[model samples]
Target chain A: MEPWTTAPAGPSSAPEMPSPGGNPVGRVEEVLAQFFMDGKLRAAATDPAYLTLWEALEQAVAGGKRSRPQLVLAAYQHLARPAERAAENAVLLAASFELLHSAFVVHDDVIDRDTVRRGVPNVSGRYRQRALRDGADADTAAHAGDSAGLLAGDLALSGAYRLLRRVRTAPERRERLHDILDEAIFASIGGELLDVELSRSPVMPTPERMCRTARCKTSVYSFEAPLEAGAVLAGADSSVVAALTSSGRHAGIAYQVVDDVLGVFGHHSRTGKADWGDLREGKRTVLLAYAATRPEWQHIAHLIGSPHLTAAEAEHIRRVLTDCGARDHAISVAEDNARRALDFLEHDGVPSPLRAELTALLQGVMDRVRPE
Target chain B: MEPWTTAPAGPSSAPEMPSPGGNPVGRVEEVLAQFFMDGKLRAAATDPAYLTLWEALEQAVAGGKRSRPQLVLAAYQHLARPAERAAENAVLLAASFELLHSAFVVHDDVIDRDTVRRGVPNVSGRYRQRALRDGADADTAAHAGDSAGLLAGDLALSGAYRLLRRVRTAPERRERLHDILDEAIFASIGGELLDVELSRSPVMPTPERMCRTARCKTSVYSFEAPLEAGAVLAGADSSVVAALTSSGRHAGIAYQVVDDVLGVFGHHSRTGKADWGDLREGKRTVLLAYAATRPEWQHIAHLIGSPHLTAAEAEHIRRVLTDCGARDHAISVAEDNARRALDFLEHDGVPSPLRAELTALLQGVMDRVRPE
Candidate 1:
């Protein structure tokens, strides 16, 4: 039911113990839920029309496994001096990351033309269905849904900043948080633009280009920013921040690799997404880049990006990818990145207990993508 | 050529003299221009792909008369203690308002399906043209253009916050600025969503609803927030803030009223936009609401909201609006609001010179739509 559960659930993994904040994941969720409720109430008082957007936003933010939030809180707990105010602010900071993620996902759905997310009708889907029920034509319905989704995303992004502003930290620290958030947003946007360009280009993307795109689009925002923001708020030294950045970058790249793998190989029931989406959309993943260099790929290349790619064609592409060693290469790369991430935690002077918790979380994420 | 030149240029109006820190408008533009140039260089260094987005953003921010920024600086100058750092910070704050305005307009263009803005190819239009020249089909090109536009707006919104964070203000004052910005953004977004809903609904939107939309969508961010943010940064008392808010609300509403009038009757040569857009788009302006109550509207009502509305038909609708007294009524409402705004400035303890300057600015805006 977690938002990051976009990957197929692998082995019932759980954290060993709660951090200093006591169940950071649960606290993050509670904070977000309350935030939405309060926001919805305010909107309702002003105008009921605004309620629809709030409802859509609420759904978008809900049911997340709170992955990003966990990283924020764990990092803060590890480095921050013991202060009650900082502890409270950490929860808010964690919630801000979740809000940011929701914003990205909502917009991503519009770009991907996706109707469902997290195994349920997404924000666009719900609005689209409503428009249809009200007798709007398909085109009108789609436009309405997309517009609403776009607005919802905007609200969430703005809300993230608002939440961060509420964190009762020193002015200097708050200023640093703002810088980190801004850089992440700028980089992620660049990554998305690059992604759109790569998708449309006739030239095959290089593996390095693909990796760079992944790091920019997913790694920085999803991993590095949250980790760094938490550490900065906690007044951690530059070395700790740098170490977390390294760890976040590698883990984030690994996460995207696994995501690409799931798109082709993971079951729909488990991943809660179309299994053939990446191939059908011709997503320029590193796996696809590696396959393009193989002679065997030439035979099925025509079938790869076809909009009407069937289950049989998907199966053929999967088989061809494995036979050409592209799939194994991608999986091995993910494993190597995950190992490097763990190595950072091991060598860095992080507190022992916090280090163990961080290790467990990263391992759990990696396990979700291990080759059967 | 300034974006805030929403009003058609009249008999060459100019400020009497520069404030304590010289021409605030000139300073704001310089800051913004430098910011964009620096941003472009950094983006280019990161990736050439990022350059396209920054270019689009630059165009979007350029040519604005710095209307919102002017309000920010003018308000700040009226009350701020004579401190060198405060003056410098005011310019940065003014630039932030411009950034936020750019963000809104970029997104608004996408929502309105407007390819041209200020009588030129807007961000989406430019990108769409590029995509087509690059061999993408019409649909792909349009989608690509919109997606890129969406990202550009996101960057601008984030960039606004980043710019504000650069303002050298006390922590408490900075917090207040954040609050004002957040509230304005939230209200404007809600107003936009309401506008979309009102447009699509088969029922006639009430005049009250239309006015509410105008105030929320235009007044808060465009008038009220800039004024309030500037005042807050200058450490103005709550009463002064309240007075400015009142002036802003009435003036902002008046601005929208004039804008609605121009949409119908203003020549494209003067307005830099299509005269028939509001009619074709079926914009639910207060003038339209008033016209709907008149019997004369029944004859040509069918012509309104037609996607293929012709120039001749637009001319006929304009005539009908006049004959029914809706156009005159709208203008009178606008004048009344402007009068109310002037009343606030006269009664409120704004400095004499600054008050006179503010009055002249507001009068210039009101004159833009005075009935011939």
Candidate 2:
């Protein structure tokens, strides 16, 4: 059930493997199972074809690292420490993050036109294959697949918010939870729109703009929102929650910066994704943005974004990126953001164990680009 | 601001003309304008391209008949009459439906490969046009358009749910409000997926299945859910609410049936939609489903889904549908559902004026096909 049950994830599917990183991940899975079971029942209650959709979602959520939910738990523990697990409702809150992430991933696949996820056929890919098998021509089959994917993404996204209704908390806290959900979803969509706009733009996007897009895309949901919700559920002091969320924001940017770097330069076996895909797609990555400003960019500008580049051409492009120092500058940006994420450790409210955990996580993000 | 300001909507963009048949629509627009202004600010807070997405949404919502929101108000006034308005929160709830509908329209455009909405360039259309203007090829332009459409749709959909947060209500009733939202969105997405699957399906869909699809697609949100939410907000008795909802469900089925018929046989000037697009798209309409069971179907089955279907060929298909009695049968189904909707007039809880309104509404749905 962990993916690669078909075709592994491409560049955008982060945390390709779930990390058992001392978070209460198992309970989150329980919440997800219950949530998805209800959705599957309702979706398929009328038609069996819809059941296939929920089934794909089940596989999609099962494949992630569960890092976002872990942030929820970690933030909760900073306030409700020594309590092995957050309450059931809080776990549902955490589960909502994973559900929303799955929604974004499914939708992202449609946007990027990627047919695979987590080494398996994504929602779009599966539907496309089925349509093809059913004898439709290529174009119609693809269209059918994307349509199904769009609807599936809707189900998951709505289901994510619906999951929040089951969580019982104080009224004010509930408002905060809704607010967090709104912010995360809103910011992430804005980020996604920015990414799409930047990629197809005739003018090259600035590195600053790319970084802003990356931060917006991943920060609020993957880090700030979930963590803030967790703290709210724990009834943590407002100041503590704010500072912790700020830390999460920086970490989100760092995480994305590392992800963008990994999309191009990380070892395929290590990162669990194909390298140079970002380059070939003409991605609005900080690395590329930096390279475009450098003199060496002229030599390989034509080679990038070509659908049929040979391995030699890719190698040449990568060497140019490295020689031009764009790769190093991007790495340093990741390092700076990661360092900033750790700045919250000495704050009065952050617990010692939480501090240790944050250190480990930031180190992990940096290690992606650091490991020789 | 009704749809077709540009290409008009195709078969699926129902309620092309916002009927001003005595519903409280003015306030709904005010709410929509305020909601979108906030969204535009947040979306464009970082980038101008993002602002264009919100602007497209503004036009999309403005273009609809606002019938769904009208349903909410109509239902509310039935329960809480003698008052000029139901309440502000209820108005927010009504507006949420229109927002959600706009979200669906935007996404539906993408799924159907439609680039126009409300007679103007849709979110996708605008984005794709810009890309083309920026020198992208047709394929890239189309992809860029669809991608933006996807994100725009997500914003509106998520915004719809977020709008629910602003409506202050009692806890239990709030739960019911949430429930209605869930049911409406879930049922609608399921309906959409079914439509997509049926159209591409190798096996011809039965008339019964097509009827079910139309009912699911239009009933819950456009009629039943809004009606139920209105009753809930007014704190009407559970039985009364249920009866009202049952009527709404019937009316919705009738509405869709009339819509399908109008898509083919209704005069273009009357319906504000092209008459033969459904036939050209091989839509799994109940009329087509019924016709497929008859002898005359063979005369035009090949031309049913053909893209190059000529006006004369379309006329032949229309005559075949009518001559085979399929058209009559479809009309009767619409009438039956419309009549069932009127049956609620006699329900114990329905006030006199409300009953009169419901009757008129049902007759209106029937009139689309009857106008001749």
Candidate 3:
């Protein structure tokens, strides 16, 4: 009856783990949503402008399933009772993910000049549109929007600190909270700087280099830190914490590599990502690496670097990516990560119920990560 | 003796005490110097780029006389033992002043875009010059420098938080430290926003509005917060803290108004400011307020708004400022502040020894601040 192994091994538990609180996934999301709303409401009295940011934050938090936090809490549940009280800690961890995610997105939008995200106008774009609608001239509206977005992002970053300052953890747990947040932010910012720098001058643009950038820039925040923070906060043993980061590192890379694949081949409706998004940005994704390795690489590169490439030209580049088997390679890499993730689950000291759900979650991610 | 009133208040003591560690004025400068150097060194390890910022920070910090931190510490000393552990609390208070000042300079540099500051090339200016020397094209170099300056300022801000987080004050003291730092930064930011909006719109250019902006934006960070934080950290009584804030507020406004005068009328070599700096930038200072209120207001306003005003014409405007006695009026305001500051030193609850030193410091500042 241990939490780590309630579900059977591999890809067979999807039907058994029903919705609502019957399964850990449903329970984790439900708890996280309520917790996020409550935290936002508590601070509403301080400033009403923040309420607008809180709403945007809630939406941006939704695309990711509660994978990292669940991994942490499931691991914790294996060692102790999984009850409502413990869920409070889980909520904190989940909200940290959302806050951290919003910080990255805000900064990323600035980097990419991305006008939209999640099928709606992104933060910067929203402000720009609002300014124009408010009767400002075009250039003034654009400048105002950019300034508002920049300041709003600054506010969110501070808001993250404010949230962490209120954590009711034991003194020992609390001491490490600031360190965790600071390190993650610093690492992510460094990675972002490198990512932006490399776009202009792809220093040693090897597949391996691109993967390192992906893992550090995106994966660490998206996965490893959240999982590791949760384990540490729950008072898990160092050994268990080490396992969480290891599994998280592998899973995080896999998620990003698949994300790269989806960015190229997936439709706008399913992933809420623009078709050929990474291709247009000249993002040095692993798929792009495969394209680089081809004899026709120069031709594909030319189209990518072209500003006025027609739809036909864009489709041709897409076909070349598929023809080079870049899509297949990306999926294989994702599967490799899932297999490695399950390997970590099977380690001898893991509690069974936690192991079962982790294995199920890994399989679920792998299945969903594949293109429809 | 109460720390707030330990200094002698006789007129004979005023000329004797204001220079170095021999009197309260000297002690404040000594304390601030040590605090600024130690803080810069501690934060220098963050990155190689930060070392460049630290250099700029060190330079920007030294330019201001140790007025605010000194006032705070002297006020604290007047309420308690003049020399009793005052050094330790003074360093903390001095650190707050420098950090708060650092924040203002960074934000102000962003607004002004004048690269040289405090007799040295500013962070933004350095970046611009280096980029051009590195053979970046003209437009690229300018853009690079602007962005570098923005990021440099952002890093300095983060460093401020890092400094505050490590403060070892008692719980109640810790609570005020939070309030002081947060409220000062928030208020200054609000003021900067208002200034930016006004510069764009020119609709709400009332003298009262400009003075309010000056008080909220510069006064708190420049004078009040540093003094209040020092007194609070030293465990001084509330009344002492209140007196320090009110006195510091007036002094801050006076200092800025004097700065406005120098920006218009002073020589570049003496003031380390371009003679036409404020005129070139079109800053709306207290001088502008005076011009707006004069019987010859329309004539002056026409010249200020005109695009064709030559350097000679700008010098004529400066002559008119002197003729209207606006410069004298500003000096009188500074004298009024000095008197108010000395009166606070004479409060009955203040200790005699501290009060004597404070009275001397006030006189010294007035001497230096007086129009030449």
Interface RMSD of each: 0.9, 1.0, 4.6
- Which parts of model 3 are misplaced by more than 4 Å? A1-101, A114-142, A202-204, A271-273, A284-295, A303-306, A323-372, B1-104, B107-151, B289-297, B300-309, B316-369
Q: List native contact recovery per candidate, as a fraction of 1.
A: 0.60, 0.80, 0.00
Superposition TM-score, candidate 1 onto the true structure: 0.94
lDDT tens readout by residue for model 3, B3-115: 01111233332332252233255544564466456545633443344345456555655555554556555555545554445465555555555555655565466455556
How are the candidates ranked when ordered by DockQ, highest leading?
2, 1, 3
Per-residue lDDT over B117-179 for candidate 2, one digit per residue giving the tens place of the 0 to 100 score: 545778889888988999999989999989888888898898889887788877998898988
Q: Is candidate 1 or candidate 2 better by lDDT?
A: 1
True contacts kept of 1: 0.60
lDDT of 3 by residue, A43-118 (tens): 3542343445455555555644444455545554565434424655655555555555665666466445665664
Cα lDDT for residue A95, candidate 3: 59
Predicted candidate 2 versus true structure: per-residue lDDT over A203-274, tens digit per residue: 678988988887778888888888788888888888888878988888888878777777777667755666
- Best of the two (1, 3) by lDDT: 1
Clashing pairs in 1: A2-A65, A3-A64, A3-A65, B2-B64, B2-B65, B3-B63, B3-B64, B3-B65, B4-B65
Worst 10 residues of 2 chain B by lDDT: B1-10
CA lDDT scores, all candidates in order: 0.80, 0.79, 0.59
RMSD of each: 3.1, 3.6, 8.2
